[model samples]
Target: EGIENTNYFVQTSKKKVILTIFENRVKKSAIPKFMEILIFCSKNRIKCPKPLADSKGKFINEIENKKYGIFSFLDGKSKNNWNKRDCFLVGKTLANLHNKNLRRSFKLVNNLGILSLKVLYNKLKHKINGLIPNASKPISDEIKFLTKEWPRCLPKGLIHADLFPDNVLFNEDSISGILDFYFSCHEILAYDLAITLNAWSFFDGQFKKEFFNEIFKGYETKRKLNKLEKDKINLLLRGASMRFLLTRLYDMVYVSENELLEKKNPIEFYKILKFHQNLENINDYIK
Candidate 1:
């Protein structure tokens, strides 16, 4: 179900667990930081994977030059499509995640941030003209616009940068778990909201206004976004769209085949990027 790592369900006599073999994209040194996040979440009463340590008190293990870890399996299923309540719950959960107070400052660089996006764009710039036809110029132009317009000095925090539908698990009406924190990083808090908005508020190549409004409704209950966050959200939305578009395009162009992974369509976000590009005012995004 996960795109970045090889995962398996291991059912022992006592309990069930998830065994994850870290893929090449995962950095071995960063595995501990990921565990720290899970531990932190568990301590805060948030439902997430808990890393199981070995007999030697080590969280990460190595086998055949590959790093691996075992995590206590979550007990809910992910939804392919979500209703307004689901959107509200996910939005509230994300806001709760951002509102936590870390005892000490943590720094984990976002490998998929703005500069990295540009590097990936340049790598695939020539190839895109052949595949998508006339997409190169718009993407390149967006790259410059986003890089220049990206805001700084907004609210910053630890965020689940990739909170897509498949990453959240639901049990009946309540959210039971939040999965896939490998893309988590210290970034703009509103940017995390933008990523969530992009992921959950679009379907069948169109944006849903009701879904977007409910998300804001639920999120404000926990942590309120300032006026600046509201004003700059469209730009952040564009950034989020471009980020996923470039990554999906990279998977489409590069040959890194794995039976466990499925390549997502970049065109889904291409349309989304176009929507943001043609926006007349910030009110179009909100009521």
Candidate 2:
């Protein structure tokens, strides 16, 4: 259902399912960990897809050397535009995801680690030339600073790194499902919150302070943020902005003609990074 994977809606006599054919970038060895995390989250009452087994009991299998997987179809529509209640519900669910995964340790490491991000930035600079003229200086400076300043010692756990609004589904007033664990990895938990803030707290190029508060409040109800996490959140926010911006930028520049994915505006996250750069305290995110 995304750029990296081909998805099809499947219907059987008894139930509906989604079948996914992973693209080439996905490593074959890592399939088990992804399936493991999905099963683990489902068993812990998290709203996510569970991996279904094949005739041989494999969660995933290869047909013509292409890896494919099957998952139960979660019944809910993805809401692109969310109100405060939506924000709070997503916040609580996200916190639940973090808490549930935090207790379990996975052997897989974050493939998109700090070093790879820096490398992405370098590739971005060369590819993005003249596209955003006069944009390089500031972005370069932020990347350079974060190279040394990105925190690594914070509380580490699994996070759904791609928890944008569309990935969260709501049925009436409650969140019914959380989708897309393909990007999940072990990292600083606060960084996950930062990504959520950038995704949910901003709309139409402006920050919604009340929505941010609702989200943060809902999050704290489940997992309390430490002083360090609060203090370093702005930096983490910048890092999150950079992460999305680079990925979107790359997609926009090099997207294939027949690709079925939407290209997000990289400039949206550029503005977010700019706003985070101006923050003097964590309260800047709260009203």
Candidate 3:
């Protein structure tokens, strides 16, 4: 279901859970912090998986020289086609996560932040261009512009950072689970919103303003964006697109095709980035 970690569903007479094997550049040192995040989310009443400890009271352990963890499997499934209510629910849930006092608990550095994006783009630049001829220059130009203009100091907190639809599972109308916190880190709260907006506000390669408005409305119910955050939304959206674009590009260029994982097309975010770049009035988009 995911490109990063190898996951298997294990069902027993007592319960069903997920067994995740760390893979595809997942750092061994960061596993504990990821478990800590799940604990924090559970404490805050955010529906997410809680890591299960073994007889030795360890949440993470080794198998075949690789770190692994078992998580309480969530009850619902992710939807491919989201309705308006789905958009609103996801937005509200994300805001609920952001509003929690997370930094006081712990801090996890974002491995895929702007600088990391630049680094990854540099690594994959030539390969990506090979895949899409004459693509390198425009991507490099976008990366430079984003690095120079990246926003700072709007609001900082723990963010899921990767809340694409497949990462979220629904039990009918409400979000039953928010999965894949591997990219979860402390970052600008509004940047997280921007990432989510870019992920959930599109349908069949087209941006839907109605869906965007509903998500914004739902998010405002819990946490209102400051003027600065509002002003930076478009830029953050572009940055978010760049982040995914590069990461997906890296995976596409390097990682081998696996039956268990479905590789996302980087061109999806490329189109998204172009859309934000061509916007005439940002104010009209958000409000």
Candidate 4:
């Protein structure tokens, strides 16, 4: 089956293997980077699909104008809808991932957290200025607030910055495997949690109390957040929401003409920011 550019499937033979093929769009330099991260995760005892080496003992193989690799096929099903238990388990897994001691370290060239929004704003700011008065001001204010608040709240570490539902696999009530380390990097662990919370707890841009509680509860079980971290959660949530909203908005406006990638609704995340604005205080959830 195809999910975006990556193709995944199980082998039919007696020796079953999970195959992942990436198109030419995946850069050659990034192949080794991806392998290193996966190997590090495996060595650190993280539950991910184990990479299978070829005859020469290479974990990755380039073939047929694409990058091909095999992993141990994990037996599980992806949930179409998420529940509190699922969200909690996923949250716990993400926390554990951030805590892993990796053998090798990687440096990020672009701040993926801010990249989407920066790109979107630069592309549309001129047009949006005339079309939607005061649109630019709110975005600028939010960016300035995040820039000042994010660094003060927490330092950086190994983080699974993108924890979307599709990246997690659930077997029964537990998280069996965590896949797709493409967006993984060294960043604030709280930001990772914030990203997960933004995706897991928010539905069409609104916070679902049950879901948020479950995710927060699960994360707290692994590692408790300090007062500063707790306060930063709301700010990070806003930043993360803006990141997705701006990217979706740009894609909706500029790239929607493209037939390949489906456009996401930018309005959903816009609603999420409004919901956060209505919160009387971030401390209410910490208790």
The best candidate in terms of lDDT = 1
Find the candidate with the highest TM-score and give its number.
1
- Model 1 residue 137 CA deviation in Å: 0.6
Alpha-carbon RMSD of each model: 1.4, 1.6, 1.7, 3.2
Candidate 2 error regions (>4 Å): 1-4
Q: Model 4 clash pairs? A: none
Instruction: Encode model 1's per-residue lDDT on 20-122: one tens digit a residue.
Output: 9987777888888989998888889888889999899998999999999999998888888789999998889999998883343458888899878889998
Angstrom error of the Cα, residue 197, model 3: value is: 0.6
Against the hidden true structure, what lDDT does model 1 obtain?
Answer: 0.86
lDDT of 3 by residue, 1-287 (tens): 45468889999899999998987577898888989889878887988988998899999999889999998889899998999999999889999998885445458888889888778877987798777668888999988888898887778988989898988998888889988888888889988999999999989999999888888889999999988888888889999999988888877877776534567888899899989998734476865
- Which candidate, 1 or 2, has the higher TM-score? 1
- Give, for candidate 3, the lowest lDDT window spanning 10 residues: 254-263
- lDDT of all predictions, in order shown? 0.86, 0.82, 0.86, 0.71
Candidate 4: segments with Cα more than 4 A from true spot:
1-4, 23-27, 102-104, 126-137, 253-262
Query: Model 4 — TM-score against the truth?
Result: 0.84
lDDT of 1 at 212: 89
Query: What TM-score goes with each of the models?
Result: 0.96, 0.94, 0.94, 0.84
Worst 10 residues of 4 by lDDT: 101-110
- Please state the error at residue 112 of candidate 4 in Å: 1.7
Q: What is the lDDT of candidate 2?
A: 0.82
